[model samples]
Target: MALLPTTAQAAQTHPDPRPLTGQEIIHDPTVARLKSGGYVAYSTGGIIGARLSADGRHWDDAGNAFAEPPAWWYEYNDKADPWAPDLSYRDGRYWLYYAVSSWGSNHSAIGVATSPSGRPGTWTDHGKVFSSERTDSWNAIDPAIVRADGRLWMSFGSYWTGIRMVELDPVTGKTVPGAAVHHLATRPDAPYAVEGPYIVKHGRHYYLFASYDACCSGVNSTYKIKVGRSASATGPYVDSAGTPMLNGGGDLVLEGHGRFIGTGGQSVFRDKGKDWLAYHYYDAEDDGTPKLGLNRLSWTKDGWPKVS
Candidate 1:
């Protein structure tokens, strides 16, 4: 016989154990699945190589992806900031959009490169996709692309204002001129910022997920992830609680302290009949250095999603 049915034992338990901390440095994680059934993550810290994992945990670094900086990188001398990178598969090619710029400002541009295979040593720079003008009001960075309803869309920006989206030609991987780019979301009232736009589709709606608050500067950072949804690809998205994301309507999706902190710059992927959220977060115990974090996402009956 066993003693059971105590009040504490019968109560609802939080799914997460205490927050995880003390991880090695890993930032700006980009996830891709190989044909060989393994996963690859390309991250920051001069780490241009792939991290191979058969089960998405326990990884081995495959060395730097690029042996030398391509001639086109203007600030290649200062190689610290690799920033946000978006990876996609199109026309038997693997396309990567990466940013090299000063953090949190528009003194930057997004560059495009492609590879015949998803492996390293095969990338060819396609040139800059978009850059910021000194006179412009918004910061141009963090390029995320997706195909919806037979159209290609790229969403990008930082705390300077909010996230914006523009139409793209699926064939050329370039912006479609005269395309109506519009604001998708922002947070003027929040403490500091809204940035890192990662968009995806679910059911009849398109969802835009972004990180908020200060991302750098260690334990003082207030970084977290929030989300908004809309019925159209170019959105006036709303949060789960029915607030307008365009009007700063967003609901908290994930935050940090115990296992993760400053968790944002996310990408969503579907694998093995399940959805996974891949993002970077600062390790709590390692003096707030950023690292890769993976979580499983599930949908509610009402169509909203949560990480489990």
Candidate 2:
């Protein structure tokens, strides 16, 4: 869903995302801090791009999330760049949610896989969890999952109708029966662009973060990260100004400034008592290549989030 930039966030100075020697060419990435005191990342690729980080700063290539992608993936993307994977561990296995679809096409599917340890080559593909087609108004991509109160929920969508959420079953790794798909956030205007939904429960509220505008155009990209929070897991979420997310409301969390372009497609992770925001951004100086971004996330006294 690439579009023109709204303002000049083009990097005129230093490139953000510093530069990892081994891990480059990132696209919509998700990470899991390994039990061995390192980090593993999964992102858009044939199967999934796997990278390893012992100290979170330096990184190295591990492998693909699956040794061979399930055959069904070819039905979605002919080129097969599997986009936006979400990773989490549960029930003695690592649960991975990944998307398969072509750009600007609604013929999309979200699939799940499990691994004993969250290493590459070890995942067992369980097949499609959810999908959407040409007839549907919403595109099923960029999936993110969160646990709230006591239930598992997944949020995903892009371009068409903004973001959508459905409750998930922990055991089956699918949607819970009788659960409804809730419309979470949307831009609702002419371009009507918003996507990349992530949910994090901080303090007494549930916060939803998403990307706005065009993504994927290198340094020319215009993506930015925004957030809204709700009292309940399923909401009527509102921004700092009390504007509802359903009504196109979001509070800006990060945007391109300096050399970072399109600062979005992010995930919130907690490590060692601190929360970290992980995402990818196009480099203006480096021909707009998408690269990994890591920032420390802190909460304000009044309950909003700020990423440093």
Candidate 3:
């Protein structure tokens, strides 16, 4: 019998022509559309870096933005695992809140860093803003700060509980003492896995968006984005069908697609008067490793957002 070509031989003879780029491995992307008409993004396990893009597609690496970890962060014995960063402009400064902790544990904290411009080498560490103590029932990670209705609010939590919102003093950017923390949403029945809370205000409503289920671990990931809305920033948020987010009330927004499993540590921004969604998805081209993904967001006539 004639010798037959093996799968390995075939692959070696005609390798995949598509080449992987720097963006392919970039995970936990947080995007900010700069005032200078470009976009800046930060990610995890890479350089503590930023990337600039004129068109929001093709990017040039700006290199390490704030390479030195804060001294307090190391002293607290927190893991160096940085995840779910949120970037925003406030008071003529760029503020970043990033979560640091070991995987699936309450030993986590959110640290602050600031820059006068949204570029590399300008960030100044502001130390830890929030952390979960051993006595607290909820796990704290995924800190997203939003300025709404003349106040600042930080939304954070994960599988041990759900998304919770606490008020922050606008000038100080720290939690206001005795300000009642609200349970904005939970998934007590559906495996109770929720985290990565990102919020946006559209017209008269405040939209609370978050991811549910496991991220990481490649093909075994069950990550998907879910959403709810409220008229007030301190929300009694509800889904479209009138279910309260506090009792596991969220409508499905985006979910996985085959190898492109949609994990949501998402951020929303407006660019040139159009809305955009920025999140990370497993790239099929790169053997299902996570990569940054962006898409336009369209509001339905009835006032719900859809990824376009």
TM values, all candidates: 0.88, 0.92, 0.88
- lDDT for 111 in candidate 2 is 89
Error of 3 at 149 (Å): 1.6
Any residue pairs clashing in model 2, and if so which?
11-258, 11-259, 219-288
Name the TM-score of candidate 3. Answer: 0.88
Model 3 lowest lDDT segment of ten? 11-20
Top-scoring candidate (TM-score) = 2
Clashes of each: 5, 3, 0
Residue pairs of candidate 3 with colliding backbone atoms = none
User: Which residue segments of model 3 deviate by more than 4 Å?
Assistant: 1-22, 75-79
lDDT rank, highest first? 2, 3, 1
**Per-residue C-alpha lDDT of model 1 across residues 187-243, encoded as one tens digit per residue:** 757432788888889999888888888787566667778888889978889998788
- Poorest 10 consecutive residues of model 1 by lDDT? 11-20
Candidate 3: residue 178 Cα off by (Å): 3.2
Each prediction's RMSD to truth: 5.8, 6.1, 9.1
lDDT of 3 by residue, 1-308 (tens): 99887755432111111232444456667888887677888876633556777767677777766776666665334545576778888999988888777665677777788888877788887777778865776667788887787889999888766888888777767778787767888876755788888889988999999888888856667788888999988798899999988888888877776456756667787888988777777766567787777777889988898886
Give the alpha-carbon lDDT of every model: 0.74, 0.85, 0.76
Which residue pairs does candidate 1 place in steric collision?
19-258, 19-259, 20-258, 20-259, 22-285
